[model samples]
Target: MRSSAVWRALPRGDLLLTSWPWRSLAYLITGVLLGEVVLLTFLATLFTGAILATVLVGIPLLLALALGGIPVAALERRRLMIIDPEPVENPHRRPERPGAREWLLLRVREQATWRELAYLVLLVVLLWPVELLAVVFGLGAPMSMILTPVLRAQTGDVRVLKFWLVTSDAEAFAALAVGAVWLALALYPLTLLAAAHGTLARAFLAPRESETGQRLAEITRSRTRLVEAFEAERRRIERDLHDGAQQRLVALTMTLGMAKLTEGAETAELVGRAHEQAKLALAEIRDLIRGIHPQILTDRGLPAAVADLADRSPIPAEVSVALPRRLPEAVEYVAYFVVSEALANVAKHSGATRAAVTGRLDGDLLVMEISDDGVGGADPSTGTGLAGLADRVSVVNGKLMISSPVGRFTLLRVEIPCAPTDHSK
Candidate 1:
């Protein structure tokens, strides 16, 4: 908020008393200096590169001349922060590799490079002169007039700058009064001019207009990476529980069974109880492994997995899936889980005795819908797990829609863009 533009902060008052006028003056002075430097350097580079073209030694120089705007624009962006407190964003993308060749290749192809070059040309030919004129007319002339009494006191009734002749104390004081008024009025226009220059600089030097799209793309890729890592970790946990803990529990159960057979009646009941406990723990571990990731989903694909879910649900359910081939692994995983969560919601809250699931591959999108007839008023916002399901779907750029009205049917639909991995019939 403190970094808002100078013009925006103008309404806060103390215009003449504040540091803004001084800051504007400084901005103009620097602009003139930078404009001269850019003009001379670019002219020399272009003319020299043109003169030595037949020898082929000037090719690199020509290329360097084209990229000269990059540094000029960078310096101007820094300079702009003097008048406009908001920092300008550099639009250039980083190179894929660490070499100069990679940097130039990327810069040359970018639209920001050309826009910056155009700004540099305007700076040299047009903008700096306008800035200089505004400063001279707006500040210089008024200050000169305000010094009329001082000038008249030093010289006897003399002409000031050969423009206004001040003959006496009254005339000199009158000229000073006019100058004071002019300076007061001039400061506002001067500040506005400086602010306008800053706006122009920012338009060219800042980030491209597509910044929102760029950020969304970055977030999407980041979420995809996180999803992949999460899936891998789930598999790792499942593998560890199956290979390590489940094996030990199995051996414990077998030992307890043998002891029950060989020991006397007194020890037999104790052995049997221990064996039962081991069996229960083993079953719980197996269920945890299934919950983490089902083997059927991996082996038989999404359709068979959904059918398995239907069979396991407490309520009777119907499922229809028509995929000629297997979808991408991530797509299938998200789709399967969405169905699983929706059905769980149906069983727990919908109070419906029956539910239906339908799925199909529609072009590049895999569409699935789960519906139930119940006293339905499901709100995803009320911690019904639909909110988390929506987030999971968005990880793969998918969409989830819920149509649940009070005292009616609840329908959950999801669509994700994906293609079948194996096309062989």
Candidate 2:
């Protein structure tokens, strides 16, 4: 695949390239130099132990112990930064609920854990030699040419590294300089690759530190804000009732009571008018309360809640809630509001005689679907009531999708996350 396409497709592939060693032999020369650097120090340590065996074995063992923990934490942070960043919560977080050592062990057995370990082991072996070769490639390459003519003044000419392989000396400064310059330049990429390997190795070995406490605090703050917002809405409803409709209804009842106390033709006429006004006021009060929070929802749960809504709807509504039991309150609430609004829309606008409300739990989601076989032209752009419902669902991390193609069935589907186990409990 094209590199541009790969990065664009997902963050993980980008992370793999930016972090992991080049997964190809095309990176071989550079990687080998890096690999050699890492392995050499430890091998030397191990070798020294054969001579002074204790020093050799003990040194690498101690070195491993000291630096082993650093790499893993760094790698995890790097991977996270490359991928989802802030919106994605840290997956390294352990389950918030309490569990056992066995569960922890099982978690440690996952693929990412082993891959990180492999990266760390590779780093330890390459750390020293890669660093050394890189220094040689970077500086030695430049130095050989820069000093060749000048150095020839000092030694007349120095011999090549012919102790074993070359078995011959360079005649002039150019000859000795050329070999050294070429060797060093050739290894430059490998030197850089070694440094990269060492860095990645240490990073992958370190355990990822958890921000569980911080994240839980954030969750608590968010939940608190949600709770406060809900309460504020309730307060607004209470105020509306106390100052507006409630006062009007009380005044209407008083007028009717006074009218009933009179005993005349005028009194009878006044009482009838007052009675009509009182009834209107009462209906307004009922509608207001339903607007605030439907009592059917709290008392009977979602199925009966939706059924009551259907029963009162202006349009004939067929309600189907085959969920044998109640769903989680959060899920049920979103579903209830969605279905209620949908039915209200049908009654107010959809000229069709019939509508249907379907509620059920599908896997981890609570799905409430309302459809009307009416003149269907629900365009979300025109600021339909469904648009508000969609935004409300988003607040709860739910999804609302509406499909009301012209002259087709108008369907409003609200899916809210309420995992089965959560609702089951």
Which parts of model 1 have CA positions greater than 4 angstroms off? 1-4, 9-14, 147-159, 165-177, 230-425
Residue range 8-32, candidate 2, lDDT tens digits: 3333434333432232112334344
Q: Could you tell me the C-alpha RMSD of candidate 2 in Å? A: 20.6
CA-RMSD of model 1: 20.1
| Top candidate, metric TM-score | 1
Per the 3 Å backbone cut-off, how many clashing residue pairs does candidate 2 have? 20
User: Whole-model lDDT, candidate 1?
Assistant: 0.81
Provide the TM-score for each candidate, comma-separated. 0.51, 0.42
C-alpha local distance difference test of each model: 0.81, 0.59
lDDT of 1 by residue, 1-425 (tens): 22256777566567888888778788888898888888898889889988887799878888887788899999988888898766787787654223476678889888889999899899989988887788777777777778888887887786755687789999888888887898788778777777878888887887765854685685686577557657866887878777767776776777676775675775776676676767777777777767767889888889999999999999899999888778888998999999998999999999998999999989979999999998888986687877677768877878787878899989888989995566322
* lDDT value, residue 110 of candidate 1: 85
Residue 230 lDDT (model 1) = 71
Report the alpha-carbon TM-score of model 1 versus the true structure.
0.51
